[model samples]
Each structure stands twice: as structure tokens, then as C-alpha cells.
Target: MDFQLTDDQRALKAGVRELLAARFGRERLRAAVDEGPRLDRALWRELGEAGFFALRLPEAEGGVGLGLPEAVLAFEEAGRVLLPGPLIATHLAAGVVDGAATGETVVTAVDGGGLVEWLAEADVVRGEATGAEPLRSVDPLTPLHRVPVSGGAGLADVRPMGSTGALPTAPLTSLFTAAEQLGTAARACETAVQHARTREQFGQPIGAFQAVKHLCAQMLVRVELARAAVYAAAVTADPVDIAAARLLADEAAVRGARDCLQVHGGMGFTWESDVHLCLKRAWTRTQRTGSATESEELLAADLVSGVGR
Candidate 1:
């Protein structure tokens, strides 16, 4: 089957890409990092106005009436730029939570009803949340808080998503997570290639070195392979397919960022460098949406059961 994106899909992805590039590029990202964990309300509102949170929500429920594939395309840009806050949570909460469709209210949910991001800032909470306790995060863009479900403190507004309950949730969320990972992997590869060409060592660009060339090449390969899996998962929306995609995507993103860091040498580890941010984000996201090991187990189970055959 052909994997090419439709023209409208390409245009939609481009529009989101251009918007994110302008709003959350390196400079803006660095600024936000320095500003700490505060949400950029203006940017959030602009993204909401642009139909980001509502992309996959039904039109009857005050959304744009698109599909998961469109949502995946939009979120790829979010990951590419390393946009902060509880993005996936808010998107999932769009029609369920008040004002999430318009970005007026920031929403958050516990991953497995345990680890919560931006808990205090969330105007609406979901997923058997009890109350949050402060926690530090590795990614400066995404701070952490743990929300235990002992008392089920915030379940009042946490409505179920129709008859699907939570069954259809994982694969859908994994699809976008994999898309985001693909974006980060692609960006990391690009960043490494750019640095390789421009940064000189021994009176010659490092890209001229065989090892550096190989590193860039490997990064590119991982990104391309992960991209294929993510795109296919988006199309299929199969749990096993999404699990496989997540596994490939998590590795590509985390490894690609590390390889990019290697290409940049000492500068890559510094707090000021964008490479570290991507690396940290990759690490955090791996934990957020079913880690590599988790995805592997899911795929293994499917294979053992011969479900996809």
C-alpha cells in the first residue's frame, strides 16, 4: 500500500509546522526554558484557535471534526519544537473538559493515574487523580508532579469518553506519542547534520570526518525507519501496530538525540544547548507513553497470541 500523505494532509502538517517554527523555535524555546514551568497562555490560545486541541474531536462536540491522522500530523510539529505543558492530556480532554477545545483551560491527567505533569496548573484534572505532590523533572520544559489516586480527589469532572471507555485510548495516544517521537528523531538528525557541516575541527568541518558522517547517516536511517512505523500506525490505529511504532519511535528519538549530542561534543551537554533539551524531552516522553520495554512486551504478546496473523 502507498504511504504517501494526501495533499491536504501535507498542507495541514506544513501549516502546523510553520506556526510552531515561528512560535516555538530555538530562541523562543530557550526563553521559555529560562522562564521555568509557566505556560505560555498566548501561544496556547493561538494553538487552540488554530484547531490543535480539537483536531480529532467530533464537530458536534465543538471540535474541528478531523481524525487521528490529522492530529498526529499537528503534534509532530509540537514535538519538533519541543513545546511545553501537558499537550496530549489537553488534547485528549478537549471536548470532555471545559474550555480545553479553546485552550482557555489547561487540562492534565495522570499517566496510569500516577505521574502527572503540570498538575497545579491544570484547570481541569482527569483519570482518578487524588492530589499532586511536587516533583522535579529532567526536562526543563516539562516539570513533574505525582498525583496519587488514593482518594480519587479529582474525579468529579473526569468523564469517560463515550462507550469506548479506556479501551480505545492507549493505541490512539500511542499513535500521537510515536508521531511526536518521530518528529524529535527527525529534528535531532537534522540538528546533527547541520552541526556536522558547520562545526570545524582540525581545520576541517567535522562532517568531513568519516565517523561524523556515519553518525549523521545512522541518525537519518533511524529517523526514516521510525517515521515509516509511526505513519503506518497512524493509518492502521491498531494496538499492536502502535506498540511496535512506539518501540521504534522511542529508540529512534532517544538514540538520535544522544547521537546528535555526540556530534556536538562537549557543547551538547551544556544547559544552554538545544541538544540536551531534546535529549531530556525524549527521555521523559519515553516514560510518559509506555516505555520501550512496555511496547516490546505488548508486541511480544501479540506475536505469541498470533493476533495479527
Candidate 2:
């Protein structure tokens, strides 16, 4: 299978990036951070108009008539900007829930881990969120709530009301989450390299130092590896492939952010810089949909069973 993005796909990716850069630049990002966990309805509607949530829906249904690859590309851009909202849920709800495709409605779901993101702000909740306890999230943008697990059934097992009977399957859900992680990893790599080239120490650019150079190099390597895995999984849409991609992406995002911080030295730790926010977002994403432990276990099971043979 050709993993290279087609011209149209590249255009779509570029369009999303440009749209986001125009809508949510650095100043807007800091503004969102200051405002705290509120959803921007106008921005959400704009995203809807841009076909972000409807990327996977059939054109006959007023969507972009695209597939997972396109959806992944759009979401990767979202991840780069750290766009705050229940984006995945809204995207999944496009055809099934009214106004979701147009971004007039906000949707959120409980993951297999029983965590609901942006629960209070959602126009629709796709799981049993009864008795949900709000948890303090490491990412200032992603507010979380935990639903009580009952009868050994996960909250994700509960059927959503007023829509399709089932939520997204774990593999697809995890794949999209991996795509977002890939974006964060790539962004961290870029941020680190830019800083390394410009920031000076000891009367020389810090990038000239072997230690700083190595950190930046490792971040690039991790991001590239994760990107390959994520793009491949998006094309394949296989459970095993998605699991592996999620693992690699989680590592890349978390480790890349830390490496970025290391490259920035003390400045990365300051709230004034976006490096720390990337790290926090990466940390938050690791627990979403499929956690690292869960993905690892799934892959281990597949290997032991010779499923890939």
C-alpha cells in the first residue's frame, strides 16, 4: 500500500493547518488558556463549516466523503494547535447526532477508562455519566470527569441515548487519539529545533552543543517513527496496527515534549512558553481512549497468539 499522501490529501492537510493557524494562533492559544475550560462555540462552528467533524461522513450526507486517513490528517493539525474541545466525540457523532456535522452541537464520550472529557460543556454525552466526579486535569484545556463503573462493565459499555446504539470501537478511537499524539510529537520536535537554532548560551548557539543537539535529534527521530506508525495505522485500520501506533505515538508525544523542554532549558518550564503546555497536553493524551498499558497488553497478546503470523 502506498503510504504517501495523495495531492488532495496534502491539500486537505494544508487547509486544516492554515485554517487553524488563522483561527487559533499563539495569542489565541494563550487566551484560551487564560479563559480556562470553556468551549468556543464560534470556533467550533467554524470547524464544522470547514468539514472537520464531517470528514468521514458520506458526501450524500453533506460531509466531505473522506476516510480515516483524511480524518487523521485533520485531527493531527488540531493536536498541533492544542485545540481544546471534545473534538473526537463530535467527529464520531457527525452522522448519528443532529447538528454534530455542523458543529452546532457539542458531543463528548466516556472512554474505556471511564473518563469523560468536557462533560459539563457537551450538548450531548455518549455514555452513562451519572455520578461523574470531576478530576483535575494536567492539561489546562482538557477538563475530565470520571463515571462510576458498575457490574464490572465499563462506562464506555453503556449505550448512548438519542443516537446510534454504540460508540466508536476501541481500535478506531485509539487510532484517532494516536493521530493527535503524533501531532503533538511533531510540534514538540519543531519547537525544540527552532529554539535550539536561535537560543544562545556560553556565547554560542545551544544547538552547537552536542548534548542539546542530541535531544533535538532524538525528538525528531521519535516524531518521525511515530508519524510512520500513525499514518500506516490510519491506512490499515487494523486493531493490532492501531495498538502499536498508539504505543509509539504515546511515547513520542510524551518523550518529545520532555526533550523539547530539555532543549529550552529553564525557559520551557515557564508559563510564558508553549513547551510546557505541549508536555502537559501529551501527558493528558496518554490516558485517553487507550492508555499505554492497554495498548501494550493488546499487542503482547496478539504477538503471543501469533495473530500477525
Model 1, range 187-220, lDDT digits (tens) per residue?
9999999999999999999999999999999998
Clashing residue pairs in candidate 1 (N, C-alpha, C atoms within 3 angstroms):
none
Lowest summed lDDT window (length 10), candidate 2: 159-168
lDDT of each: 0.82, 0.86
Worst 10 residues of 1 by lDDT: 155-164
> How far off is residue 80 in model 1, in Å?
0.2
Estimate the overall C-alpha local distance difference test score of candidate 1: 0.82
- Could you give candidate 2's per-residue lDDT for residues 15-82 as a string of tens digits? 99999999999999999999999999999999999999888788888888888889889989999998
Candidate 1 regions exceeding 4 Å error are: 149-160, 163-167
Report the alpha-carbon TM-score of model 1 versus the true structure: 0.93
